[model samples]
Target: MSPACFYGDSSALDSILGISRKKTEGALGQHPPSVSYVKAEQDDLLGLQPDEPANPKVLRVAIIGAPNAGKSTLSNTLLGRKVFPVSSKVHTTRCKAYGVITEDDTQLIILDTPGLTSPTKAKRHNLDRSLIQDPWDSMKHADLVLVLVDVSERWAHTCLSSQVLQCLSRFPQIPSILVMNKVDLLKKKALLLDLVTELTEGVVNGKKLHVKSLSRTHLDPARNNPLPSIPACTPENAPKDGGCLQEGSEVQRGPGSDTSCDAKASDSGHVLGGTEKAQTATPQVSRDGKIKKGWPHFREIFMLAALNGEAVETLKRYLLMQAKPGRWEYHSKVLTSQSPQEICENIIRGKLLEYLPQEVPYMVLQETELWEEGPSGELTILQNLLVPKETHVKMLIGVGGQLVSRVAREAGEELMNVFLCDIHLKLCVKLKK
Candidate 1:
């Protein structure tokens, strides 16, 4: 009498039908162009049962970094598709989203979370508060962390944000990989070597990491064109990113290397003691004036351009190989867990960021009003762009409404590609009271 073991719901009809699946063929047995219904008993509902065998391995990786550090770009690249919206502005990602990678014997679940930044008193919207806390929330569920660093920046070595250092310090138990992103932008090859050496030695907070170096200089075998070369490009043959995706070999786990970090005591630093409180707050700075002592030891290091699909394949393979045996948390075929509405919101906001002036991007907000699906695989989306000032609205509208038209066109085109249907995107510019 255990409620008759209702899997999804106890509805009598669903219980009798077991599981209902939809098919493309018509219910009337029509060929080539209609839809139909199918019913099947799936053991997948409860996942692998205790008595059942054949359980595959699963790995959950969390990608965290500073705002505009190419985290969304890297997440899209690793997922081999564009689900997370990408833009040049900060705070592009407002929540944690999953990008699933299904392989033969493993499934890699990637959590793409908002960039870690300190909460500000002025920007205290619910969304802003969520953005600051989402990364730490996702960290609790991660098996491993991929820390992406913007290596192309001039202050890349010493200008590590205090927020990032605090995050790394808080999670000393979880193993992390240091990913040096945007290496292709380096004009000089020697600078890469110097940067790597300095990064390995640079003390953060106060602890110096014993970093193991396995640096690969080349983005790909085709140095000039890092993206994998495709045989041809046609309407039917083109890949998502204008080329084939690069697939690299996984890094084999070797004997334990000494990558452990030690805690130090100072006016602002805390000593490494288990559950023992220090008398004085650990001064984040050491004698050398390093910011904090809670630096994390990176188990693996990778340098690649996520935009160009460099070394991304290697990163994927490594994650797959690192998978520990367990029940998969998500379905194999599900690329993203974001709803259609959420996807549209991100896309529209991203487009707005791209076309608007720097000052105007932050002054604007987008919200989806309505979503309707047409009979012929078409979509009608109604969204409103709210601006604080009428001047901002005027700017967004442009002369003769040209700027809004451009955004609609670009967003519709990308939407059509992802949803495989014509999109009618209606954007209204309204002044916020």
Candidate 2:
């Protein structure tokens, strides 16, 4: 039997019952194993009967949100591999990259898209057109949409971004779910219930509901002291003092614990939609009958910390169960549609963003000088960093080229792990003008 098949196993039972088992510590951080692929026609050992049905199961999910909302982290976590590059900087993913996850008979094509920005912001920053266009384009072909929000960030926790709301309003037909990411950093556990009530407008899976309030006498201390207004970490405004927190990094202010609120709370007191009763309450609709603040039609709400893979298994299983009969798009062994060079470019760019100070990484451009493999099955990559300014070139190279050396070393290490082979990566900094 093929390794992908889980027939008669406990995993199969878990899938049926919607149970998610936490991954082991070793399994949580390990890279996916490399396997040789055989053509579907030539291989009949996929654990499928010869007379099986013609249609296979497939699902295309588009993860959309504001910049730095852990979209790439969630994508990598769901795929069980780090195919996409992630950093503290926003707009790290400049386009829509596809990551495929095939388990048994289901194939999940994840569209990791660029952050959604308004047209004015895009033009002001002279950003790539893809940053504004790709999110909508991804939704055009998506079977499901996941609107991710960084609940730990003060600016994003209370309300959805305007662009996100517009996207949800534009595509009312597509099924979307609100994914509240970074729950580990949310100090006040009680705020989760309020955040959910605000974002979903008290509607979960088409049902109007309310959250049972905690006793005023027993108010949580953390609730009294809310998180400070720290702007969402983006490339233009990333702290120069190295104060920005990256994904998976812990904050010293609070204890990290998994918290979730059930939608089946009492139907009384301070209805979210401002009605006296839950049954009579409804989402805030505009004059054209479209949602105004948050999406009311979210099919489900998932609270997860994508950085450490917490609660991610449940979301993955839920997505697998949502798959319907369709033709498979790619081979089972394929994890991503990005080519080696593209992957390399993204990884290098991510490292540059991570190590370099504000605005330097974004200003630098990459060019492939050479890509070759050795006789011993190792890879050699020569890439150039093109900077517009002489000072920028110096910044990239650093004193005695220490900075660039670190970027190359760390990037090559990650590349070796990703491709499962030794890599000789050389980087050169050049002045473009």
Best by lDDT: 2
Candidate 1 lDDT for residue 360 = 85
How would you encode candidate 2's per-residue C-alpha lDDT over 1-433 as one tens digit per residue? 2212111111211121122233333323334434212223223332333222356799999999999999999998987766688999988999998887776677789999988998998888778999999999999999999999998899877888888888887787888888889977877644665787798776655555434444444443666443332222222233333322211112111122111111111111111211122242334557885455677777766767899887676577778778888888776656677767777899999989888888789988899998887888788999999999988988899999999999999889878766778899999999996
Write down the TM-score for model 2. 0.76
Candidate 2, position 83, lDDT: 66
For model 1, how many clashes?
A: 10
TM-score of each: 0.67, 0.76
lDDT value, candidate 1, whole model: 0.59
Q: What local lDDT does model 2 show for residue 321?
A: 75
Clash counts per candidate, in order, are 10, 0
Model 1's TM-score against the true structure? 0.67
Cα displacement (Å) at residue 334, model 1? 1.3
Give a tens-digit lDDT track for model 1, residues 35-55: 110101122321423231277
lDDT of 1 at 113: 88
